[model samples]
Target chain A: MSLRERYGGMTRAEQGVSLFVCGFTALLVVALLTGGLTPSYTLYLAGLTGMYVLLSLGLNAQWGYTGLINFSVAAFFGLGAYGAALVTASNSPLAIPGGVLVGLVLAVVGSAVVATAIAIPTLRLRADYLAIASLGLAEVVRQIVLNQRDWTNGSGGLRGIPDVFAGWPVLGPLPGELPGLQFAEYAVGIPGLFRIRVLGFTLGEPFWTDLLNFVAVVVFVAAVYLLLRRVHRSPWGRVLRTIRSDEELASALGKDTYAFKLQSFVLGSVVMALGGVFYAYLVAYVDPGDLEPINTFYVWIAVILGGSGSNRGAMFGGFVVVAIREGTRFASDILPARLPVDVPVLVDVYGAIVSDFGSTRLLIVGLLIVLVMRLRPEGVLPPQRELLWPSALEETDE
Target chain B: MALLELLANGLVFSSIIVLASIGLSLVYSIADFANFAHGDTMAVGAYAALLAFGVIGGVGPTVLALPVGFFLSLAVGGAVAALVAVITHVLVYEPLEVDSIGLLITSIGVAFVYRAIIQLRFGSNPVEFGIPLQRPIDALVPLGIRITVHEIAIVASAAILVVGLHLLLQYTDLGRKMRATADNPSLARVAGIRTRRIEWWTWIIGAGLAGVGGGFLGLYNQLSPRMGFDILLVVFAAVILGGIGSVYGAMAGGLLIGVINQLMPAISNVAVALPLVPNVGPAYADTVAFLIMVAVLLVRPSGIAGGETT
Candidate 1:
C-alpha cells in the first residue's frame, strides 16, 4: 500500500495524538522565539535541549526503530563534536568552507568507522555481550580521548574553538554609504526597532546567528524525520521490524539481519555525530567530561519517554527531557537559601548541596527511567504497529 | 631490602583486592546483576568501622575496630541489599519482567542512585583513619619482609572470611537453600523454597561481604566515593576469570588479579630500557586492571567459571 493510504487507515486517536504533539511543538517554538518563558540564562539551556533532541532522535532510529540497544551514543556524539571542533579550529587543515560541512563529513565517516570496528567482533555475539562490549568500548573511547593529549588536548579539553556562525554575513551593505554615520546614529532612527542597516539588509549579529542555527537545526531534523518516515513505511522498514520481532525468522527468510543492524547502528551513530557538531558550535567548546556514559543513558531515557520507534516522539522526548533539566536549574535559582550554619561554613555547605544536586540529576533521571519503564512500557507514544514478539509462544498467541 | 619490602606491600595490596573480588563474585553469581554499588557498600563498611574505632577509644582501637566494622557492615549491607531488591523488583524488574536486558539497564540506574546518595553524603573526599600499628615488623627474622600489623590483619581477616564463606555455603541449611535457589529459581520455588527470601538473603550476605572488604580496604587505602568504581573493573575481572557462579573461582581469580596488579608495575619499571614501553608505574594500576578485563573478555566470553543463569 502507498504511504498515504496506510497513514489514512490509522485510528483517529493516533491522528489526534499526532496533532497534539505538533501543536505542542509549535507552541514551544513560538514561546522560544517570542521570549515568553525562557530568559537569557535559559536560552543556552533551550539550545542545548534542542541539541539533545537531535541526538535522541538518532538513538531512537537505532534502538526504537531497529531494536539495537546502543550504549555508546555519547561516545559517537563526543567524537562528532571533537571532529567538528578539530576541523574548524584555527590550527586544523580543514578550517575553511564554514567547518560545518567538514564536521558533518568527519562525524559521519568517523561513526561508520567506529561502528564497523566494534560490530565486526561484537555484532555476532549475544545481546547481553553486545551491551557489555559497547559499554566497554565507550569507556575505552572516553579514556583514549582523555589520554590523547596531542589530539584531544587530553582531559584539559579543547577551548577557544571558533563559533560556527561567528564570521557569517549578518547584514547586507549599507544603502548609499551614509558617511560619518555611526551605529549609534542608525540606532536612534527607530524607537523599539533593533536593526542595523547594512547593504540594504537590516539585522543584528546575535539575531543572525540565532536564526542561522535555528534554521540549520530545523532543516537537519526535518530532513532526518522525513528520511526516517520514508524508511519506516518502506519494505526495508518492514524487514527491520521483522528482525527486531524475530531475528531467526528474518534470517531464515534470507535477510542479512546483521548487516541491516550494522547499517542502522552506523546511521544512528552518524546522526548523533551531527548532533555533536551542533552541540560543539552551540557551546563553542568540547570537553571529555561533557561526554559521559550518563549522557548516553539520558538520550535513552529521552527516546524511550518519547516513544522509541516514533521519530517525532524521540524529538519530543528530547525537548521534554532538556526542558525539565533546564527547568530544574531555574527552579534551583528561585529556591530560598536555607543554611543551617553561618558565614563561610554556610556558603561551603550550601554550595556543596547545590553542586551535589546538580551532579545527581543523572540519579533522578535514572529513577525517572525506572518509573517510565514500570508505568509505560510502550512509551509515551508507542510505534503504530505491534512489532515482533521474540518467542514462538507470543507469535502463536497473537 | 627495598624490593623485598615492595613485594610484601604488593602481597598485602593483593590480599585486599582478593577479599573485595570474592565478595563481588558471590553477589554476581547469586544476585544475577552486577551491583555497581558494591564498591560503595565497601566504603560504607569502612565508614562504619571508622565509627566503631571512634567509639571504642583505646590504644588497640584499630585491631578492635575489625570485628565491630565487620558486624556493623554486615548489618548495613544486608539491610541495604534487601531494600534494593524490593525497590528494584517493584520499580525496574517487575515492569520489564520478560526483558532481562531492561533489568540490566535498571540495575545500572539503581547503582547510580546509590552512588549519588553516597556522593551527596560523603562529598567525594577521601576519609582516612589513623593507623594503630607503628612498627611494621620486628627485627627477629632475617631477610624477612617487614609488614605493618594492619596489613597482617587484612590478610588474616580476608583468609578467615573466605574460609568462613566456603564452609557456610557448603555446610549450612541456609547455604543449601541459597545454592538451590541459585541453581534453578523456578525449580527451587516449585520445590517449596522461598526463592525471594533466598535472593534477599543472598544480597544481604553478598553486600555484607563487600562491606567487610571495603572496611579492610579502608584500612589499607583511602576511602573515597569513586573507590568502588575504581576497583570495580578488577573485581569483575576476578569474578569473570574465576567463573561467574563459583565462589572458589572468585577467590582464586581475585588473588590472581591482585598478584598481577601488584607485579605489573615492578615489571614495567624493570623494563625501562624498552623504548616503546613507557613505565606505567604505580599510578596506572586501574588501567592495568581495565586492560586485563578486556583481554579476558576477548579471550573467553564464558568467563573462567562459566555463566550462571541465576
Candidate 2:
C-alpha cells in the first residue's frame, strides 16, 4: 500500500500519532547524520525500547487477553535478569558456565514457577485479591534479593556480566573483528557559508555490540509477536477474551477458566522474564533496584496507554514509556542551564529537582494513569479489530 | 526480657496499623474499591502534620511527652487529609464511570501522585516530628519494656480515636446510615438514605482516621515520603486478616499484625530453637504477614471476623 493510502485508512488519532512518530524519527535521523547522537547510544535506546515492547506484550497476554491483573511484572522481569546475572556474572556465587542459553532457560522457568505459586491461592479469589497478592510477591522477592548476600550480593549488585552473545563462536569476537567506518567527511551544503567540517563519526566495537544486541531483541520481539498473533487469533485466544469480558459466561460454556487463567498468567510472566533477560544482557548488570514496584507500573502504563489486548498497541506503549523515561532525563539535563541561578534557594531547589528528576517521571506516570482512566480508559489504541481463525473469517465473509 | 520489650513495641506499632487499617477497610467497603492511595493518604497526613508541627512549634504544655500543639497539628493533619480525599473523590472517582478495578488502578496513580508531590516538595529523605525524644519511662524499663512516653502516647491516642470511631459507628444516626449503605447501596438508596452523602462521610471518617494514624506513625518512626507506602502492605495484611470490609475486624487484625511485626526477632529466635527450621530474619517480617494473609485466603476467605463490620 502507498503511504497516502495507508495514511487515509488510519483514524484521526492514528494520523496524529503517525505524524508525531514520523517527525521524531526524522529528528533522530538528523541527529545521527549530524554526529549529535552516538550510534552506540542510539542503538542502546532501541534495544531498551525493544525490551519494553516484550514486557508490554507479556502483560497484554494476561491483562489484555485474559483480564488477569498481574501486578508482578517487575518481579518476573527481575527473575529473568537475576537468572541471567546469576549464570553469567563473573562473581556469581553459582558460576554456571552455560552462558546465555542457561540464563534464558532459567529466566523462563523461574518466572513460570513463581507465577504458579502466586496464582494458586489468589486466582480463585476476587481479581483485586490477585493484584494485592502479586504486589506482596514483588516485595517478598525484592527482600530476598536485598538480604541474600550469599546469592545476590545484597544491595552491592552483580557485576562483570558477559554480553548476550559472549559464548557464541562467530558473534563472540564479532564486534572486535568488525571494521570501523567513518561517516560524513565532506560538506553537503554551501562550501564557505555553511561549511560542515569532517563529521568523522566512527563505528567501533561498542556500536557493533549494541547493533548485535538490537538485532537480537528485534528477532526476539518478532518471534514473540508472531507467536502471540497466531495464538491470539485462535479458538483458545477467543476463550481467553471471553473470560476477560465475562468469566461466568466462559465458565458456563464449560471452559476450564481457572486452568486457562493460570496458563495465561504463566505465559505472560515468562514473556516478561524474557524482557528481563534481554535487559540483563543489555545493561550487563543486575541490581535489586530492577524489582521496584514502580517498574511494574511503568509496564502497566504502557499496556493500558497503548490499548490493552492489542499487541501493536503494546508495542506503541512500550516506545511511549521509553520516550517518557528518557525524555524526562533529557529535560532534566537541559533544565538547569536555563534556570536562574541568581537566587540561592531557587538554585538549590532546581538543583535538587534536576538531581532527582525520577520523581518527576513518577508524577507524570501518575497523572497519565489518572488522565487515561478518566478521559480514555480504552487507551490510545484499543483493539479495533476482532480476532478469528483466518479460514473461518474468510468463510463467514463469503 | 527482650520478648516483653518486643511485645510492648508491637502494641505501639499495632495502634498505628489499626488506625490506618480502619480507614482502608472503611473506604474499601463504602467506596466499593481498594483505595491504593489510602497509604499515601496517610503519608499526606503525616506530611501535613509535619508542616503543621513546623508552624505550631511546641507552644503549649506537654501531654504524654508530646506538646498540646502537637495534638492540634495532628488534628490539622487529619482534617487536611480528609479534605484532600474529599476533593479527590469529587474530582476523580465520582466523574469516572468504571468498575471497582478501574478505581483500584487509578488509586495506584493517585498514590504515585501523592508520593511524587511530597518527594518534589521535600526530597526523599526521612524527617522527624521535631518533638524532643524522651528517656524510657523508668518503671517500664525495670519491667524490661523500654518504650518511651511518646510510644505510650501513640497507643493512648489511637485507643481514644478507635473508641471514638466505635461510638460513632454504633450509636450515631450517620453511623447507622453508613452501615445501611455499606450493607446494600441500592437498598439503602431505596430506603431514602442518601448513599452518596453517606459515602462522602465515609471518606471523611476513613481518611480522618488514616491521617491521625499517619501522624502517629511519624512520631513512632521517622517521617519520610515513603513511610506510609512502606507500611501499606502490612496494613493491607491486617485488613485482609480481619475480613476486608469489617471495621472492627480491621482493628483486631491491625492489633495482631502490628504486634506480630514487632515480635519478628523473637519469632526468629524461636525458629532457631527448632531443629529443621531456618532462622528467618526480622527483614522478612512483612513476608510473614503476607504468608499469613495468603494462608487466610486459603482457609477462610471471609476473614476471622466473618465479614461482620459491627
On lDDT, the candidate that comes out on top is 2
Grade the docking of candidate 2. medium
Clashing residue pairs in candidate 2 (N, C-alpha, C atoms within 3 angstroms): none
RMSD to native, candidate 2 = 2.3
Across A1-398, the per-residue lDDT of candidate 1 in tens digits comes to 89778569666645755666677667666554443443333346556767887798789878886788788888999989888887776544334455567767887788779888877666665665566557667777887777766677777776666656555455222212223322321222365766433222233444445555666777777787778777766788788878877899999999999888888888788889888988887777788987787788888888877787887678778877775676567556665556645688667656655766664675677577777767775677787543332364357758
Worst 10 residues of 2 chain A by lDDT: A332-341
lDDT of 2 at A81: 93
The TM-score measured for candidate 1 stands at 0.80
Task: Assess candidate 1 and give its lDDT.
Answer: 0.68
TM-score of each: 0.80, 0.96
DockQ list for all candidates: 0.40, 0.73
lDDT of 1 at A51: 85
Candidate 2, residues B1-310: lDDT per residue as tens digits?
A: 6999999999999999999999999998999998889999999999999999999969799988788999999999999999999999999999998899999999999999999989988888999987778999998777898989999999999999999998898899998998888898899999999999998999999999899899999988888999888999999999999998999999999999999999999999999999998769999999899888878876887888997865
